[model samples]
Target: MLGQALLMALRALRLNLLRSLLTMLGIVIGVASVVTVLAIGSGAQSQVTRQIRAIGANVLMINPGAARQGGLRLKAGTRATLTEGDVDAILEQVPQVRAAAGSIAGSAQAVRENRNWNTTVNGTTTNHFVVRDWTLSSGRTFNATEEAMAGKVAVLGSVVARELFGTDDPVGAEIRVMNVPFEVVGVLSPKGPDQDDVAFVPLSTAKLRFLGSAGGTARDAVAYILAKAVSDEAMARAKASIEDLLRQRHRIQDDQEDDFKVQDPSAAAEAQRGATRTVAILLTSIAGVSLLVGGISIMNIMIVSVTERTREIGIRRALGARGRDIRLQFLCESLVLCLAGGLVGVVLGATISLTVARSAGWTTVIDPSAVAVAVGFSAITGLFFGLYPAHRAARLDPVEALKAE
Candidate 1:
């Protein structure tokens, strides 16, 4: 009996193929939108997670805060208040600190032969690698001996290496930074954007050759300090200790603001994750509205279908067809329409997401659960909206329906 009802429903849909297709178009669009948005959102969240992991959750950044001069406030990190002493003090005074490194940065053009690319040059100690959790992809990182001697050695990030040396190995290659030649000692592993388009040099070399020494002040003055805690749970304590040590070192009074700011990258990462989740939920809600609209359209069409087939219903009833059978037939028709539309929408949405990821160089992850939920929701929509129409058709009086023209 069920199979027969489904077959009849298919035949009825076939008789009005164009209208059936048009009626399901809304469902198709809505499901596709939901799937595509979810893929993009999941991808974004994964990317953020990767970045956070790469940087390490136990890291803390201490930056020189804004300084006021003549009623004008300078940008943060412009005051040059942070120094190497602060980095040493943090490691020595803070029991939670595992490692600390001071660093300064400047923009320079790297030239090897005729190939040259502009990139950021970071001046840092060997401990910087420990704090950043960066690893060498090729060769080796410079040792403390080289750092102390201000050796003219450099490490290339993946992007800078690709730009300068192509497929050739950059290890032991000579590159000029601002006309000062240095041998590339190593290449860093890829760490996504912002972190990859850079070059690392010994702190002393950068201070002397590129950044220029301000009466030996440049060697001591660093833009920021990166400190890594012994464990993730110790980050807050380490931050507090570093703040107290710096405040004492800088001789700040109780009423005055400190000259530095402590930052936790983990907090920033959490905020970013929250924002991405909020946006995904909002977009999904908007897409769900489209599904509701599609359901309403299905309800309206089903009602019209029942009215047009009144005589058919009456004839079936006269032939001993139960009201439940008539109702089931209409319900099956609605379910079939929605299921077909949902399947097509899934395929379309997956295609669109893959295309966007390829063309835009973005990450996209299609969750099986999302697809299942979308299809299931569509089925529920069909049943809910088709209920009233199906019930109305089942209750039609055979005598009156048969008399209608």
Candidate 2:
């Protein structure tokens, strides 16, 4: 009985193919929009996760700033409280800590023979590379002797190398930072666009040269410290130990606020994922409005169909066709229209996603669950909107309908 109703519904729809196609347009656009937005959002979350993991999720960053308070958080490096001693204490006293490194950063103009480019210059110890998990693409990292002697040697990030040397190898090249000449000892592997625009120099050299204090005070202060846990499971212990050691060294009372902040990348990444999910949900809701519009169109068309077939409905009722059968037949027509539109929309959405990924370089991840939801929602919309029209058709008075025409 259900199969016969579906076939009759299809035959009725075939009588006005163009009108049927036009009626399904709204459903198609709504489903496509939902699928595309979800795909892009999921892809962005994945990309963010991958980029954060690349920087080492087990690593923690300690910056000199008080904890955030009432929408007023001190920016990193605003306080000069963090020092080399804090780095040493964390490495020596924290058993869960594997390595720690401190760095101070400032931007400088890098000049070669005839080429010049501005880049971020970081003054860091040898362990900075290890803590960051950064590997050299060519040549080697500055030696301990160079670091200890405050040698004027630099390691170039991939972008710095390309900008300064173009197609030529940057190792063994001499580039002057802030008019102070330094030898380029190595080029680092690519670390995305943001990280690739930086250059690194020995801490001793920067302190002796570019980072001298204005008041002739001790220049042992560092901007931030990077630390790596011995293992993923040890991160919490490492954080706790460092907090305890710094509190003692900084002489902060038990009730006093801390003058520093520690951050975990994993927690930040999770927060980002939450924000992404919220945005995706908001976008899907907007797309749902289109589905609502499509359902209304279906209802209007079904009502017109009932009016035009009033005499036929009466004829069928007089020939022993029950009201329930008439109702089911109309409901099936609505369902078939919506389901067909949903399937086409899925295909269209996927195609558009791939095209955007290729042309705009945006990430898109087409989740199967999103497709399922879109199709299922469309089917439900059909049933909900078609109910009134189906009932109206089923209630027609056979005697009156026959006598009218």
Candidate 3:
């Protein structure tokens, strides 16, 4: 009996294939939109997490500033109270700290003969590399002797090397920074586009050559300090220990405000993740509205179908067919239509996602759960919308239906 009803439903839909395809358009669009947005959003979240982790886990940043009332944070280097000595103190006194480095940064024009490029110039010790988990791609970093003697040696990031030297080896090359000559000692491994436009020099060279006496006393001025904890579990303790040590060194009274900020990368990553999730939820909700519109379209079309097949329904009933059988047939037709739309939508959505990723250079992670949810929602929509039309067809009196034209 069920097989016969299903066959009838298929036959009725086949008679008007064009109309049926048009009716499924709304469902296809809704499902495709929802899946595509989710895929893109998930990919963005994952990319952010990877970038943050690339900065190294168990790492903390110490900036010279005070947190003001009303949750406002003063800009980095606002106080200029932290110095190289603070870095040494943190490494020595804080048991949780594994390593620390003092750093300062400024922008300068790099020139190698005719080829010139504007890039960031970073002044830092060897420990800065360790704190950042960065490795040299070629040659060696400056040794302690060069750092202490203030030798004019530099390391170039991938972008800087390509811009100034092209295919030529940058190692053993002399590049002028701010009109001051410095020999390139090494090239750093690429760290994406954002970090590749920078050049690293010994702390003493940067201080003596560029950014002289800008922030504070030359002997005591540094932009910030980067520190690595012994392990992930020690990060909190390291933060607390550094804070206490700085407070004591600065001689701040119990009530006086702290002139520094300690930042945890994990906390920053979590905040970004939370924001991504919120945006995903909002987009999904908007997409759901489209699905609701599709459901209404299905309801309207099913009603019209029942009306057009009134004579067929009456003939079936007159042949001793049960009302339940008529209702199930109509409901099955609606389900099949939605299911087909869902399958098509999945393919469309994946294709769009891949195209966007390739064209825009944005990451896209297609989630299996999202596909499952979309297909499941379509099935539910079919059942919910098909109910009233199926019941209406089942309730019609055979005598009355047979009398209609």
Worst 10 residues of 2 by lDDT: 211-220
- Local distance difference test scores for all models: 0.90, 0.88, 0.88
TM-score of each: 0.90, 0.78, 0.83
lDDT of 1 by residue, 1-405 (tens): 989999999999999999999989988988998899899989989988887877765899899878788999988865778887888888888999999998888899999998999999999988888888898899888787888888999999999999999999999999999999999999999988778999999887888778753224445888888999999889888889988999999999999998899999888988998898899999989888988999999999999999999999989999999889999999999998888889888998899999999999989999999999989989998999989999999999998989777
Candidate 1 vs 3: which has more lDDT: 1
lDDT string for model 2 (166-235, tens) is 9999999899998899999999989788788999999888888896531133477888899999888998
Scored by lDDT, the top model is 1
Candidate 2 stretches greater than 4 Å from native = 1-22, 66-76, 213-217, 282-293, 296-300, 310-332, 343-376, 379-405
Alpha carbon lDDT of residue 402, candidate 3? 93
